[model samples]
Target: MKVLVTGANGLLATNIIAVLLQRDYSVIGLLRNEKSFALEPHENLILHKGDITKVDSYDALLPEIDCIIHAAALTGQDIIDYSVYQEVNATATENLYKSALEHNVKNFIYISTANCFGFGSLDDLGNEEKPIRFPFSNSLYAKSKLEGQEKLLRLAKDNPDTKLVTLNPTFMIGSYDTKPSSGRLVLSAYNKRVLFYPPGGKSFINVIDAAEAVVNSIELGVHCESYILCGENLSYKEFYQKVTKQLNQKSSYVKIPKFLLYGIGYIGNLLRFFKVKTDISLTNVQTLCINNFYSNKKAQEKLKLQQRSIDNGISDAIKWFKLN
Candidate 1:
């Protein structure tokens, strides 16, 4: 099978491409620049330079492509504009699906965020069926991803022949994070004497496990269905301790009060009003204070996703960060 993966230089896409090559599948990686790609050259891998939102850039390659893993996304809490998010996350996704249909691409896998679903407490974890909740609902990034997921599912209903599977992964951490996207979380407390963290916690998954689930979705996933690819749920304090332990460093963990976080968020809002781009906001801080936990039972059952210890992910990220 020949697969086309967008955001070829991204953390998740890098790992996904590696898995595809290991499984003996031909891959065409679509990204803006070939020079910034993270993966090493392989016989089955081909890098194609292109813009994800512009379908015309790689429209000709769609004919021979068997599957497309749409992993490219405009993420971050810093962007203040909804239009920017919509253009990349929502509009581009719908356009790609339409083009894939025209070109006879049978399998389309979309990598979305777990924030699309409502988060729950440790006792009751969130699942694919839950509706999105506050903070995340107010988040432009999450809202945009949900829009993309809805559009794909709606389009799939009319076209039964195409297999449209959406995988919503939680906070992912592992190696090959060239941009050091989520690896920033791991670096935050590494070798630190004191670690200040938010009171809330969320679901986390190893990138390798998330990549494997994406590949399994091609054969095992049901049409128009969504899966939450997640793993252990740990509070910020607990997670920081794990990081400290993995790095073999001693650190004191401090939990920032919700009030203080909200105060900082207000300052962030003021900065944004003055045309300054900042990630600290009321909604973003609120997201940090809640238990944004989720369940991986659906993915484990259907996609055969294995829940590896987050410790391994932490270790791998630390090793990669130190080297690169």
Candidate 2:
């Protein structure tokens, strides 16, 4: 079967493409930029230059595919405008689904964010059935993603022939991150740049394991269902400790107060108002304040999903980062 993967140049998409090739499936990678070192040369792998936001660019590629893995999205970066988030994450997804419907695609797999279900603590874990706390999301990226999820689920309910499955993965770790998008935390720690750690915790999984969950969903996944693919939950301090121990670094990270972080965020907003480039945005600080814990029980039972230790994930990520 031929599977078309959008955002083929991204971290998760690169990993997913590798797994698809291993499963003996013909793969077409829909990437906006030119293929980088992230992609390996393979006989079965075909790279198509297309933009997910522009539906007209990829309309021809839809008919030649048996399945569509819509992994493309705007994530892990500070957004200056809300419209960009809506265009890339929400509106683009709706357009792709419309084309998939018109082309009679068999299976449609969407990779969504676990944060859609909102913040979760140790006591209250986010799950598939839980409703999203939309008001809590300060970032346009999260809001747009939630919008995309709702629209896609509605499409799944309306269309019976085309099977639509959404996989909401938690914070991802592991390799092949040329942009170093999801693996930014690990990269920062390894480089001794992570001095202050946030107090909030999050559920995390290895990227390879996350990829397997997506591949398994191709066959074992039930139609019109949303699966949360998560792994062990750990706080920012705890995660930093693991990285320090694994890398054998003597430096320790200090727990920065949330209030101070918010202050920095407010400063970032001021800089933005003046048209200055800033890394630390208010949305970034807001996200770091939330304890985004989630449960993977449903996926474990149904998709046979299994997550390895966080140590293994971190170690692998460090190795890949050092090499590339």
Candidate 3:
């Protein structure tokens, strides 16, 4: 089948594209630029240059594609421009699903986040039936993704020919992530920059496993249903120790108080008046390091997913980080 993958240049998207190619599916990538990290170069892959949020951008490309995997979104926990995410995360999805209905695409896989579900304990494995909306629903990125999911579900309900499935992953760490995002924090531990550790820990999964779940959902998932793609959880101390072991070295360590981090966020918000460019925006870091663990049983059963141990993910990630 011919599949059109949005955000073809992202870390996760690159991995997803690799899996699809390995499975011998005809893959078409929608990319805004050739230089994007999500971009894949292959003979079976057809790369189209276009903006997903623009009607004129992907309009022609949608007709011949059999499935659509939406993975493009703002990368950070912080809100860059709320409007930009609204268009890319929420609106672009609206356009894609509408076009899927018009063109009769068989399946649509949407990549959502477990962040939509507030931070939970290891025991709190949320399923598709559980409601993620709670007091923490006020956050910008989560709210936008939830809005997009709702919009897609509405489309799925009304349209029989179009199939929609969304995958919610927790704390993805893997290769091809050139950007120094949350996963890279683990890498930073080895580099000696992460001398201190955060208080809260989270569920971890290999990016390859995350990509596999997305492909499996496209191949066999029930229409209009969403599943949480998650794995093992740990405290920051445990996570750090795993990293330190693989590095085979010792580094200074401290437990960063959450309140202080929040204070920094508070100060950053106040400093927003001065206009800051750093990613450590009061809003971003605080929201990210917030402790949370989610369940993956739903994805394990539905996607027949297999997850690598967190140790392996860390070792592999650190090796890649150092080699690069």
Candidate 4:
């Protein structure tokens, strides 16, 4: 099968491309700039320079593409404009879906974040059926992705022939972090004497595991269905301890109180109001103070997704960081 993956330079997309090549599938990676290409050259892997937000950039290539893993997204809490998020996360998705249909692309796998679903406590984990919850609902990034998911689902209902699968992954950490996206979490506490973290917990997964699930979705995923690809649930304190243990470093873990985080977020809001770019808003801070946990039972049953130890993920990330 010939596959096209967007955000080719992103941590997840890079891993996905590696998996596809290992499975003997031909790949076309769509990236905005050729100079930013991170993957090594391969006989079956072809890199294309294009913009995902603009359909014409990749319209001509869609004819021969059998499956498209739309992994490109505008992510970050720093951006203050919802329109920017909508353009990349929502409008781009709609345009790509329409073009895929016109070109008869059979499988379209969208990569969305778990924040689109309501998070639960350790006792009751969030699932695919949950609605958008607080803090995340206020997040422009999550709201935009949710908007794209809804549009794709609605479009899929009328076009039954094309299989549309959405994979919602939680905090992913592993290798190929050229931009060092999620790896920042690990880097933030690396070799530190004291580690300060929010009081909340989250569902974490290895990027390789998440990438495997994305490839598996092409063959095993059901149409118009969504899966939450998650792994072990750990609080901030527990996670930092794991990081310390993996790095073989001694560190004291301190949990930031919710009030303090909120206060910081208020300051961030003021900065944004004054046209400054910052990621410390109340929404992002509130997200850090809650148990944003999720379940992978659906993905396990449907896509045969496997859950790996987050320790391995941390180790890989640390090793990669050390080298790169």
Per-candidate Cα lDDT values, in order, are 0.93, 0.85, 0.77, 0.93
Best by lDDT: 1
* Residue ranges of candidate 4 with Cα displaced over 4 Å: none
**Candidate 2: lDDT of 71?**
94
* Per-candidate count of clashing residue pairs (backbone under 3 Å): 0, 0, 6, 0
Listed in order, each prediction's TM-score against the native is 0.99, 0.94, 0.91, 0.99
Candidate 2 lDDT tens digits, 166-255 = 999988888888887867887677657447888688798988889999999999888888899999888888888888888898665788
Candidate 4 local lDDT, 1-324, one digit each (tens): 999999999999999999999999999999987776777899999999989987888999999999999999998779999999999999999999999999999999999999898889888889988999998999999999999999999999999788999999999999889888999999998879999999999899988899999999999999999999999899988988999999899998788988999999999999999989998798899989899999999999999888889999999999988987
Off by over 4 Å in 2: 134-136, 191-194, 274-279
Candidates 2 and 4 compared by TM-score, better number: 4
Arranged by lDDT with the best first, the candidates are 1, 4, 2, 3
Off by over 4 Å in 1: none
Minimum summed lDDT over a 10-residue window in model 3 is located at 276-285
> Of 1 and 2, which scores higher on lDDT?
1
The residue-by-residue lDDT of candidate 3 on 22-141, one tens digit each, is: 999998888877774543478899888887778777878778888999988875644545675677778888988898888888888999888776557666645566666443375567
How good is model 2 by TM-score? Answer: 0.94
lDDT of 3 at 92: 81
lDDT of 4 at 280: 77
- Give the total clashing residue pairs for model 4: 0
Better of 3 and 4 by lDDT: 4
